[model samples]
Target: MATAYVDYFPLYIQTGIEAGLLDPELATFDLARLAAAIKPERDLDFAFLGLQTLYDRYLLHIDKTRFELPQAFFLRVAMGISLKEENREERALEFYELLSSFRFMSSTPTLFNSGTTRPQLSSCFLTTVDDDLSGIFAGIRNNALLAKYSGGLGNDWTPVRGIGAKIRGTNGESQGVVPFLKIANDTAVAVNQGGKRKGAVCAYLETWHMDIEEFLDLRKNTGDERRRTHDMNTANWVPDLFLQRVEAGGDWTLFSPDEVPDLHDLYGAAFATAYESYERAADRGEIRVFRRVKAVDLWRRMLTVLFETGHPWITFKDACNLRSPQQHDGVVHSSNLCTEITLNTTVDETAVCNLGSVNLVAHLTGTGLTAAGLDGELLRDTVKTAVRMLDNVIDVNFYTTPESERANQRHRPVGLGLMGFADALFALRIPYSSDAAVAFADSSMEQISYHAIEASSDLAAERGRYQTYDGSLWSQGILPIDSLELLRQARNGDLTVDTGKELDWDVLRVKVLRDGMRNSNVLAIAPTATISNICGVSQSIEPIYRNLFVKSNMSGEFTVANPYLVADLKARGLWDAVMVSDLKYHDGILSQIDRVPADLRELYATAFEMDPMWLIKAASRRQKWLDQAQSLNLYMSAPSGKALDELYRSAWRYGLKTTYYLRSQSATHVEKSTLQGTDGRLNAVPVAAAPVAATPTPAPVASPITTSAVPATPPAPAPEVPMDDSLLDAPAVCLIDDPDCEACQ
Candidate 1:
């Protein structure tokens, strides 16, 4: 790391200059001052995972000799974003201070290629493909271009004709979206991001599409090789009418968009009426190539596919559009790769979101956290600066396609999210599943929403409202909380929400209504999987995966223990060799340990130990205020069809925009990470900073994970096992499948 100053820095600059990657002015910076500003001590802040994430993909490499250190990487991104400021040098220092100190972090692309030859600083790009063959191929080309850089792709396939539909140009029947999706999947694999990570894209199809059934099978292990798209992500763009049909036990009719074009553009009651009309028309033989099925049966199949193959994610189409501030610009066709992004995409315009996350761990008070709760003013300041950094990305970004650039400049949307929520909650000593945790979730997210809006309003004052802000929901002062009524209407009063406003919304609405807002949409809670690892905390809005486990990533497997749990244990003199053995033998949960306090056990329950509704309930509160969606994942120790039905129904009843994956305990995939082997068992190693023990963390049993299909594929009939209290004592880690699109996090 020290060589960044004496050796690696000048060589990198020389290489950058030779490749025309660095700004000409960068070569003239005072090296002496830069070296002085660099604090190598901050490097110690990185846990093994954070340092490895930086080393493998982020650190600048010359002939595979790692050079750019962590602090320097922050400064480089700061410099790149500040290039056009009047006092750019000083502004760079300011940005560097915010970043190096871990108060803020830009998205992966911004950190990776920021000051490089081809700087692509945006995280997500949403585009709609035209229904024609030329347009479809063009969309494929666009995906390649964007994925070649760093943008995760979301393509809306709703407009395309379904299987057996007549094609006017070719005088043949359409093969439907599945064949094209395979190509897109291959495109994602073929266009890896400089071999650092896989290029990720998600194809979205509306539930009414005739190809929807086949689309769900894209990720199955035993599918026709031509149909399986294991490399790409798939999501269902479901409308509220379908859920109502499932509830009412009505038949759902699938139609080709070619036969029923208007349904794709409609939502709410308009959609229901148009869809019923299409069903009647198909019954009268006015429409061709239609299939009818029991809505509940189809719903079961969707859940089956999701549970079996880990996708097609269930994302509500109407709720996303109904709640969208940018609904007037165009309908929200689909969410982005990780499912947190909700933006409009059309053939003429591509939606783009430049993302940054505030590290919530830094939001503690000056009076020490216990004395005073969360510091609201500091959170506002952090969010304001983060918004500025994200806005700067719109100008600094290298748009791969003209459509993306056009839409980005017009709407100027930015996603300002948060990470380390679990860490913050742990610091506050709130149990993961408690009512207090739910209340805290509501308050903290309300604070983020409160300040993020004010900060965006501040930007509007300085930079003027976004080009399309005049007729947006913000222009009418329709905040996200107010838009819940629209969703209630869409779901026909089935949705339940706590009708409470904690903040002074009346005053803020007036301010926003009078001044307008800068961004079209804000506040997306991404998976934050990789970045949370980089920050050495729990992933976005997630509980601890395990109190101790081995984390596998681009870096080699490293022993990871929840440092908060360790500190609490060490404080009570409960951390010892036997405690380590017990933790390893029982897979890092404290329920089986008799010596620990009951409250401590309750507070430190692993992801699988607590009921999942707690996670959803908490997310529902955040979703109430978030303009964009969240990458919410549902976990179950024992899953059954009935259980899935109730769980998803509750998710809709609570009005969540999207859910990522349905993780099951017995079916955990071990491809990415495992903690079972004797060589890899995590002992008392801290999650972040703690005094090292005289002896290293002990690796328990040496048994490796079973590499077989049994673990990967659960039985067809979802297990109906009751929640067993005894299973909490079992020696199994709560392994989560990392998103294929870890680059965005």
Candidate 2:
């Protein structure tokens, strides 16, 4: 550490230069002065996982050795983002301060390739396929190119027509969207970037599409091998009319795009009208390849597939398109891999979004219920900087396809999301199910929404507004919160949609109308399961998974104890090694422990402990402020058909644009957590069936990440590599920053 920073100051640059890891322009900076700006002490704030994540994947490496320390890595990223600024050094310093302080971090792509030769900085891409062989193949090729760069992708499969549809070229019936989706799913698996992680592409099919039934079955375990797409994620793009039909228990009909192509171009009233017209055509035998079923039956099948296989996520088509600020430009045919992005995709343009998340815990002024709270000024400052960094990504990002580049430049969309909501709530000592939690969610997101718009508008003042700013909802002075009225009007009093706003929307609305906005869309909430682990916080807008249970991911299993829970317990003289043992035995749920206080138990409720309604209520609140969407996972202990049905209906009624995964809990026994038995060996504790929410399998590790800012201990030794290429092969490395769910934060 001394040799890299203090002794030579600019040694990292020299080392990087020799290894050919440093960008040529990056080499021209007065790196010695920049090296001097590194705050080595700030490294101590990071828990071991945060530091380990940097060392293993983020730090620039030569061969197998990592020379970049935490502070220097932060500075390098800052320098990369600010390299084009007129006052590069000053701006870099500002970026460094924010990053080194643990206040904010860019998405994975930015961290990986920001200062490298190929800076493909955007996190994910969304594309739409036209109903043609050339266009479909082109969409698949674009998916490969983008996935070859970064993993997350969203493809709209609705326009590709359906089974028994006429084919002009072959004079045979079309095979429908499933066969094409299979190719896309296989492409994602085949084109993973340098084998870093399996590329993930979410194929979205509308509920109205005739192929929707098979699309829902793509993830089923018992499905025909040729039909199942186990590798790729799937989502149902349901419009409001379908939900209304389901609500009224009316008959629902599905049609192929080949026959009812106009339905693909409509939404809300226009969509309902076009859909009925298509149904009438089908009745008259004008439209072929159509199927009719009870709306509730189809809705039930959608839920059954979702709960059974956890794919084909439920996303509201009308809600997404209706709420989209860029609805003027095109329709939002699909959401991105994580179900957070809602950008428009057309035949000529593939929607793109650059993503970054604010570490919510870092923005809080202090820790614990009494000390920690959000300072309005500080949050605004952090969001302003984060928005700027995300916007900068647009210019710096390397696009893989012309369509992606075209869409990105025109709409200039960015997903400014957040992590550590659970952590922030823990600090405030709020129960996940409490009304207070909902209020906090509502207020915090409102603040983020306000400042993000303000920052975007401010950027537009300096730079010009996005190319498609005209005729957008923003041009009409309609903010996301105000757009609910549009939905109410579009639905014609069939639904009562409320903004549930605690903040003054009118004031923010006026500011937005006056200043114009730079970006088309903002404020999406990602799972942040990976990035949160790097920052040592809970996943985005999610309740704590466990207090002392092992979190197993690619890096291996980590025995994470909730620090805030510990602090609260310790304050009441309840926390100790015994308490830890008990928590481990009970699988980190406090309610099972008799000695724990009732209030603390409520505050420490895990995902399955609270009602799914609370999740919906809070998300609905957050959704009101967000212009995009959130990757919301709803948990159910012993999920039932009736329970699942009501939950989704409530979600639609609350106006949530998307729900990522329906994580059902299983009745399983808790295992002993590294506790010694009579033989002084770890024993599995045989206990009553404890409910466990389903999550991606956790891979526990034996080693712990060191947290000292200073080198109180030497850097951990690196694993050895074989000299012969064929002698030894390393296991495929998966990104550990997030849970299996896109590992985002």
Candidate 3:
């Protein structure tokens, strides 16, 4: 075997010089000493798949030649962050340690393109346009510019007047929002994220718009291709009045924005009053044209399209506006891409959020609620730490556009969210639907929301408050918990907590008023699709999809199991050929297994077993504390339109701002095996039945019988190779011993 000891110090210095990431004079200082500072052994930590992903996409390569090493990558990121800091080297080293230890990481765009020329690091962008000819096309150009630089765009199209109202200036009937949306869609396709990924945009419309029916069909395959925005995402910015209509079975009126100018600006009770007044105006024949449909009927069609094509996610305008710290700034029109960020977007100000997710599984300690359960104290501490990390990211992140930089710097907004929530619950053996689990969800998120605010307040004490923090909720000493006081006042006519739990509202409120906060918005729950997988835990706050399933990565397909389940079954003498067959028969559910106790069954119900309502309820509980929104996913085993309607309506009633991904399982069932074989590949015999009244026994310390009984041993460690700097920023390496980590996907 050949050994290669390529010194990384000179390479780092050279790249820093070439990229202007460091001063050229620093390149000559103690090259050998810096080389000694690099830990070569960290190179051994890379799993084969992680290495492959890095080689394929992450590592900086010039004409198929790799120049930087793993340590070099970390150094580049650290250098990028500490470029303006006074103690640049010390800060750089501290950041390097954090990244190397996997304590925290920047967003994908940041990791991919930072420290390089034309660095475009923001992940999401929001834009709004007026209905006029130039204004509408100007929005399209803005989308192209942002997308060209690898930023996700969310455009608010509410100001665009609906189809066929009237244009007095032209003396002609208008073509409406749909025609403009189609042009916006094509621009998204044309400027495809600099070929890094797909050009992504989300078009948001107010529900009162006359062209909403056409907007809903933009992603439908049968629609006229010219009118469809198949490449872009669509969302309905629904107000509370629409929800009330759906709840009351009342008629919904749609009209052009020209006729109803203030509809988009008003919300909650005021919006309802204005909408009713508009309906009366239409009834009096004061408006040009109008159509009335059952609110529930419109909601059902929205859900049906969501389930069918997975576009136009549901976003609540009332909830967003009511809870926003920037509510005084303007009515929050829409959430950004992925529906996790709720910020004020306008024609001039394009809302931008710098996002980061905490690894919840990393904070788990055995002393608390075990690995699979909720630990409020640990969670609180972790959230505080995460808030600091995300706040730091805002200062460190490279902005692609001037608007995003300005917006981010003014608000200093940071989204501190979690990955591995479901995995954490699984480790604690708490069922997703149980009251204990729901209470834990509420308490845990409340702590995160509370401490995150406190952490930001502490940061403000040192660095000063965000530019727009003065008139915000935090300035009024109203934290998320204190906001709940307002809700309590609204509901019961008093700012009192009749509930038994003695929440520490007074302390948080006092701190906020005294210290203020560094950031306007501190917390949000984003859908951890790619990041969660890298963390090797359940994606955000969703139930386990399956006990055993295939995760297809670039390297190849690999079978992953629920680690907690594997451990539990092994201890109970229940993990065997027969158990595997039973689990396979039920599509990874252990609920129907006669031997598995009811408690364990409840604790480990798959996504199919837990009611979709439970997911919404849990989200609602968490939403109360979250200032922005949650990337909530509702899962149904065999979904009907009626079931989805109920789930969405309940979400709306509970004051959820945004809902992402309506994941419904098909009615298709796996075919049962009927093949006969003595070797038991297909026809394994069941063991003798245990006593019906058998008491639950504690799991064994370890299984004695090994390879003789089982056909396969545990997988071996992947091979190592010479360190490649290009692969350092790839996804985190997966530890083979921890199967629960796979749940993050």
Q: What is the TM-score of each candidate against the true structure?
A: 0.90, 0.90, 0.82
- When summed lDDT is taken over every stretch of 10 residues in candidate 1, the lowest stretch is 698-707
Ordered from best to worst lDDT, the candidate numbers read 1, 2, 3
lDDT of 2: 0.75
By summed lDDT, the worst window of 10 consecutive residues in model 2 runs over: 694-703
State the C-alpha lDDT per candidate: 0.77, 0.75, 0.66
Per residue, candidate 1 scores C-alpha lDDT tens digits across 1-745 of 5655545555566676675656665666655566567777777777767878889878877677765768778878887887666777676777887787777788888888777767799999898988898999999999999988878889998988999999887789998988999999999999987677889999999998999999988987775999889888899999988988887778999988988888887888888899998888888989878999988778878877777777888999888989999888788889999888999888989899988888887776533223135778888878888887888888878888999999999999999888888877676666667666766778788889888898898889888989999888898889988988888876667776665667899988998988888888878987777777676767888788787766677766666667777767776777765666677767777889899888678667878876777777888888999999988878887766666776777777788888877777753322223334444333335223453321112111111111121123221222222222332232222237464657567
Estimate the lDDT of model 1. 0.77
Model 1: number of backbone collisions? 2
The true-versus-predicted C-alpha distance at residue 674 of model 1, in Å, is 11
Give me the runs in candidate 1 sitting further than 4 Å from their true place.
1-15, 19-21, 28-35, 366-372, 666-735
Ten contiguous residues minimizing lDDT sum, candidate 3:
702-711
Off by over 4 Å in 2: 1-9, 366-369, 494-507, 666-673, 677-740, 743-745
* lDDT (Cα, tens digit) per residue for candidate 3, span 249-283: 78899999988988878876678789899899999
RMSD to true structure for each model, in Å: 7.0, 10.7, 11.1
